[model samples]
Target: MDDTSFLGSYTVGTDAGMCCLWQPEHFAHVTSYDVWEDALGNDPAIERSIEAGAFVPLYLHSDGVYQVTLRTGARTPREKRYTTASSEPYLLVSKGAVALSGIEAVGADLDAAETIALAPGRYAVEVHLIDWQAEPGSTDADGNAVDGALPDFVVEISPEPDPAPPYRRTVETFDLPEE
Candidate 1:
């Protein structure tokens, strides 16, 4: 696997007041698929990746494409306020193309993320995270100033079911002299 293929770690944690390192999976090459075109939306690069089996769509939502999952770290059901945040903000799986797949501000401390069904295979993946900044007069649903950013990263995927290679088939026929 190449060092340039990864963006960073998917999750970050604080231990005894120390920041952990960001270590994500890596892959030498990727095999992309366009399995979410209809459900999501369209992108020429995504289509090309699928055709070439170079990368797959993990999450996408922009310019009419909406495909992602909501994640809220809140545990209590009656918590008045629960803030949601995420690392792994944006992704660029193609050779040199970048894509945004992070969630926007909703309410009730809800966060957004992407989900994909894999066929069990090793994949070169791009991981996206949020890099938030404070806006002077911005306000969220809960009356808090909105601050967020989209940062892209990369990782390697290993599906359990292991995806099948691109479809290919052929036929052969033989003929005998009217025996």
Candidate 2:
């Protein structure tokens, strides 16, 4: 399986510790509330969005600049050594176009986002965690600094006509109190 079927690559900045791949038309609906804030705190608002098929919310481990690459075909790239961090199903309900941007850029700085066209439907997103431990002082293939222990990721999106329900979460920032 060729994992080099690259669709696009983007450099996104996240001050809110999260980013998302969403359809432009559904931007207003997803951002209608403070989904970004909720995502940072791991609030229920994010979960609601996930269940409602609002968008594909990514909870980054740290708040900073990260490289996000979009690809099709094989989930993980064969060229680099990456571990399967998490895989989730995403239901895209909008036009055949989507944009990748920091959650904070929703209404304020969407102009700085990277947009791509895709068949609007259900898709699977597999997040691959880059292993920087092998080369302690070296950078990744994308020239990103490997000194920091942040869990950066590469997301592979593929068509999933029948995505299973009850999506699982990949990243969680807080723990819920015992009810």
Candidate 3:
């Protein structure tokens, strides 16, 4: 057999009602793109769609809390959300993948809560048991590095990347006390 584990097989659906791009429900989980313009609404329309999986953001916030908006469409038969592999760690990349001059973190088994605390910066995070793989590289199940056989995983957290920030952002604003 070929080492097809490195190659991914994703599909796109048509008629949506007639043919499914892939059996999303079949996979452990599936990710959906947000169709709504206002991602900040929290009505039944938004709350109903987010059940188990997660709202894989099509965009990112320059700053502050972010919301993912989704609307029901033929392209979106059901509410789609990205399923995080909480059970494992981030994926691995060649040492070359890391930028020798950028800010990055390298460690083993870094907690999600702790990682979120880092200021906006690039990092080469290493985790013997977990690395928090984002995407593309994350497609590889072995990227999680359960045995810690891989070297190190490099992640770039720029001012703003194409997708959401490489690391997850959880910020909460508060009201200041009145004088």
Best by lDDT: 2
RMSD list, candidates in order? 19.0, 5.5, 21.0
- Local distance difference test, candidate 2: 0.60
Following a full C-alpha superposition, what root-mean-square deviation does model 3 have from the true structure?
A: 21.0
Which should have the higher TM-score, number 2 or number 3? 2
What is the per-residue lDDT of model 3 for residues 70-179, given as tens digits with 9 covering 90 to 100? 11111111111122211111111221121111001111212211112222232222111112233234334654423322222112222222453233221111122379
TM-score per prediction, in order, is 0.21, 0.69, 0.16
Cα-based lDDT at residue 158, candidate 1: 22
Q: Which segments of candidate 1 are over 4 A away from where they belong?
A: 1-45, 63-121, 124-156, 159-179
Worst 10 residues of 3 by lDDT: 98-107
The full ranking of all candidates by TM-score, starting with the best, is 2, 1, 3
What is the C-alpha lDDT profile of model 1 across 80-103, one tens digit per residue? 122123222112223332222321
Give the C-alpha miss distance for residue 131 in model 2, angstroms: 2.2
lDDT of 3 at 143: 45
lDDT of each: 0.25, 0.60, 0.20
Candidate number that wins on TM-score, 1 or 3: 1
